[model samples]
Target: MLLPPKDSVLRQASFTNFWISRILSSTSFQMLSVAIGWQMYALTHDAFSLGFVGLAQFIPMVLLTFVVGHAADRFDRRKIVCLCQLIEGGIAALLLVGNMAGWLGREQILLAAAILGACRAFEGPSSSALLPQLVPKHILQQAIAWSTSAGQTAQILGPSLGGLLYSLGASCVYGAATIALLTAGILTCFIRVERSERKTEPVSLRSVFLGLEFVYRHPAILGTISLDLFAVLLGGATALLPIFAQDILHTGPWGLGLMRTAPAVGALLMSLILAYYPLQRAVGLKLFAALAVFGLATMLFAISTNLVVSLVALLLTGASDVVSVVIRSSLVQLQTPDEMRGRVNAVNSLFIGTSNQLGEFESGVLAGFIGPVPAAFLGGLGTIAVAGLWMYLFPSLRRLRSLSES
Candidate 1:
């Protein structure tokens, strides 16, 4: 019998640890997010407040991303990661207490959600920057794929768990999330860090902005990042999923969980297939096409009445999202040098953070105004339109070849 390569065992171990950490951290945070959204909407029946939930964290993230990125470059990344994990655990614990005491009115819950987002703002860049340190540079792409798979897998499981737990009460969900975050902190303690390879120049706000400027000037890097950002920003209907599950689909919390997980199921399967075989050929064209598919999937989901149809739509949406993530992350990692990775990634965080959290805000506002279905459909159309505009605007992105070929 023919067997796989001899190095497969070593590769699998690194992949396992890398992915397990992602799953744990993502599950802790996402479960909290779904629960917060579910509980807040239940209490207030307002989508705008749901938007506010993201605003709280995003403001802090935008403010601190440069500092956090600088710190990641300057300090031991493993320790920085551990500290963030611990802070998140503390935040989660506070949320649990707020939920349990019945002291958490909508205002208090919003405050807690903001604080959690603040922690995540720091956590995200550090975690992303830490990946290259975990594996050989050759397998960095694989590590990213596995990490996305892990995150999506958690996305699949976490919301369902959150919805089920939320049915029992918000306290249960918050408590479980807190425990998961604390465990994440404990796991970070196990990640050993060598001294940073980054060169420390005197840190200044102007220096940080230099990194942002660099991203702007690099078309392949900026273009790919913007493609993903705008695509997801306009098309992402996550904030309105609760409405679809309850009002449209005529299902309860369980259905909401299923909808949340649907994308992950699609992304995970796509990632697994791509892991063994690279998606390197004609990557640029594929990226644009993926976003187009993403827009179409969201549009289909917006009109979908059947549970199975909605699930399939969301699954395609997730798969497309994964494509965007890989292409964008690869562009950044390839263009960035080891010394500037932290600062550059910090800027990347701002781009992505604004897109995701602000996208949530956009979804909530649009849904509140036009109704959830129309908002989602319109958002998808907007995403497709942006991709078309981008294709015309960025000639460099269209011309990009594989990193190996380059």
Candidate 2:
């Protein structure tokens, strides 16, 4: 596929549509999370049930990881993403109906979570693999930065929007999400990629597992992926925000929405900066430095009782996280072969899913046992420890100088 000319990324109609669609899709997804989290907590009032919600969603992704990667490599990635968005829209409608009819119980909520997770398992990897096709190679990294900005913008808006809508009613949030997702799907249908890759390979266990194998073969890729996994697995504090908002923070859903938006505000600013003036030198050291900063920020959030301090800590966490994310995402795409891109990205998503969804579950369970403050505090300590250990164990990753480096 020939990319657009050298000037701007958004100039390409396909890329522009994709970018806007990303905003819509991501915004809806983020909004759904806030609604689900708040609604579940309102219904159950148990910290453990909040974590259970994450686990329910996560299990489907874990089960479908290998299979989803194969589908991305074998099928039309754009179409796959389109289908996922449509399905998600339907799910949102279901939630709306359930909410309006007053039968959306814990069982219904968890089931919906699981179904949405399965769809995302496919959507995320397909979109990751499809991104490079829309822009010139020289600006791929910048496109990624802009792409990160799109998602961060959604995060910035989604939670707060969701929280606000909840004041009107849960059905309003779901209704808005449904509209956004459907519009996103329509936008995706406009994306036209050159379908030149051969899909002749038969489905087999060996083929499905190839992405996992490829990641292991590249030490740099392995290190970055695992580093994110461990760091987020330990440092995820967003999961406990409900407890904080309701109990410690003593705020309503509106306050929870603002709390969720805080990190995204920081992330949006940082992503815009990286898009314009990207990292140039000592990329490796910068990665570690960002990781360390993320850990410290998590620690700060853990102990803080004041809303301002906690929001500040989350802001730092998001800013620092985007640094590692952009570096890792660029490196992963740059390093992988086009034929293997889908599978590799799927492997990447697997780690991401584990860290995010499972991490939420872990935070919930730990919070249930020890309390949210102690759970978050220990998790921050664990993140710092992982950063140190990874630096020692993956010297090549620590020593890497550029995304182009093997």
Candidate 3:
């Protein structure tokens, strides 16, 4: 038997279209985030309000997960994704109008966040579940890695662009995001893939809970997902970044942009390396080790008062996170059956949304009480402890060797 040539994922037209669409959408999201975070902090000067942004987004996403997951599995995923992107673009347009009207305030931004979150609840599962249909199974890991690299590349550019546009005005930043999202939606329409056969089971409590049941039965999946949930939930430092940029490091919006870009810079470099030379052995142990480094980096970032030092720490955090992301994503994609991918990914998205958005809320609330520096320090400590405990608890996950073999 002969082996197929490497980088075959690049040859697929549907995957290429999907990849480009991802870049556009991810870039728009990053830009929108930068604008919202900066504007919210600037308006309220309250860390709690900044946290509310995450809370607003998190609530709708978690609330609608099951319904959206069912929709992804039941309907045409491409259309679902395309429609969601269009809705997101409309939200961006709303933000632009509000900003230009000179009446955009914290409440309006929070409402926009809630609306965006609702769209994303549907978008996440559809997009994730759609990927396996675009590429051959043998190249799925490569496809995932490359796709992530593209996203990281967007992160690298998005914040910097957002900051520059923001300098012109908040409306300018929103305008750019609107254009990107609309373009992404257009690109999404061009993607062509054969849909998987739909499940014919009648809708019921059992059908709705099928994804949860599948994940519950698999110890490795449960362990990995839960580990990320708690680790990032505690250790995420993004919410306090405005504080770090303004009060701690004494930097303006331009400096904040650089601070935000540091992690993606690190992740992008690591992703490029992984894309060519994928993780081939000791996948589980490597994940744990990378997570340990991530925790350490968070602590280092917490204590750093100097701008350059903080950037380095953030860079390390991003680099370490890339390893975890690639390994975990490959594991989830490989282990999941096609029919269950949507629902399973919906559950996975909830974990991610909790870790990211809810984590922001936690960081904000903690910062309001304890101060930003100590909040981050404590969170980092919690991350390290979680990693150690998870390693001991999930022995099967720890002993896992390869993505393909698993």
Candidate 4:
């Protein structure tokens, strides 16, 4: 009798296609962000506006979280993701035309940002839920690791490429982004997966709240998810990089691109290592340790005047972050059933979005009141505190020894 191929997810055709799609989409998203951030800062020259960019995207994510989660559970996730990429591609084209025609303003940018946020609200949950369908159960953790590596690869390219393209013009960046997103859309369309039987439960508050309850009831899953939520919420300093690049680092758009790229570099390297080696033991202790390192790295970046030092600090943050990410993601997926992945992942997505977008807003507000340096310093300190607190609050998480520990 014929048998399936070896254990590597890379050998699976569907998984390969999924990984490629993720890389393309992630790269396009990163490039788009670089353009939006630099353009917003250039137009408004204010920290609050930068913060507002995050808020604009975040608001839609918050409002649609339940609906999108339900849609992922009930609909064809591939189609949902494909539709989002296509719409985002069109949005990029609109930005391109608007920029070239001199009609793009802060409002237009914010509007596009809001639309993209809504699209991601659907895309993030569906894509995450689709992963387990592509690989065998035994190799799922490796698949998650590889998937992270794909995103990091995109991050490595996206910011630098976006920054470089921006020098030519914002239009150049937008045009390239449009093409990348369109290609990603097409790629997503071809990805194949054996989806779980769709949940036919009528849309209701009870159904929508199921994911939240599922997460809350599972202490380990809740711990990992909340751990990431709070850690990133406190440690996120990415929103301030444009300011750091232009003002403190004494660099231009190109420098900002590199600064944005630094963490991805660290993350990609770490993810690749994890993909090959995989985490074997003391996973819980490692998660907290990574958070501590990430916090320390954030603190270092905040205080550094030299660009090189800052980049190094950022790199450490990324490397440490992926360790926590791989562990958390693996645990969440393994713990949840296929039928529940969509809703559960949606809840997870909300926490992630909240941490990232809210963190940006918080950073901007804090930076506005005090200064970027003090604001970032405090954020790092806050992240460390969250780590310590979570250890005590979720001893189950702290005691976790493996992703499959059950």
Looking at model 4, residue 301 earns an lDDT score of: 94
Off by over 4 Å in 3: 1-11, 34-54, 94-111, 169-171, 242-256, 364-375
Whole-model lDDT, model 4: 0.87
For candidate 4, write residues 181-215 as lDDT tens digits: 89889988888777566658887889988889999
Angstrom error of the Cα, residue 357, model 3: value is 3.0
Model 1: CA > 4 A from native? 1-15, 34-52, 94-112, 166-171, 193-196, 240-257, 303-305, 361-375, 404-406
lDDT of 1: 0.78
Q: Compare candidates 1 and 2 on TM-score and give the better one.
A: 2
Model 3, span 1-406: residue lDDT tens: 0114563443466677888888888888878888998999999999999988877877888888888877777788899999988989999999999888888899999999888878878987889888878877776777777888888998888877888899999899888889889988998898888756766677898888788988888878888889899989999999899999999999888778788889989999888788778888898899899889999999999999999999999999899988888877777788988778888889998888778867888999999999999999999899999999999999988998988654
- Please give the distance, in angstroms, between residue 393's alpha carbon in candidate 4 and its true position after superposition: 1.5
Residue 216 alpha-carbon offset, candidate 4, angstroms: 0.6
- Give one digit per residue, the lDDT tens place, for model 2 in 1-406: 2244654544488888899999999999989988998899998898988977878777877898888888888888899999999999999999999999989988888888888888888898899889987776667778889899998988778877998999999999999999999999999999876556655588888899999999999999999999999999999988999999898878878778778888888888899888887787788889999999999999898888888898899999999999999999998888987778889998998898778877888999999999999999999889889989999999999899878787
lDDT scores in order? 0.78, 0.88, 0.86, 0.87
TM-score of 4: 0.87
Worst 10 residues of 1 by lDDT: 1-10
Per-residue error at 401 for model 4, in Å? 1.5
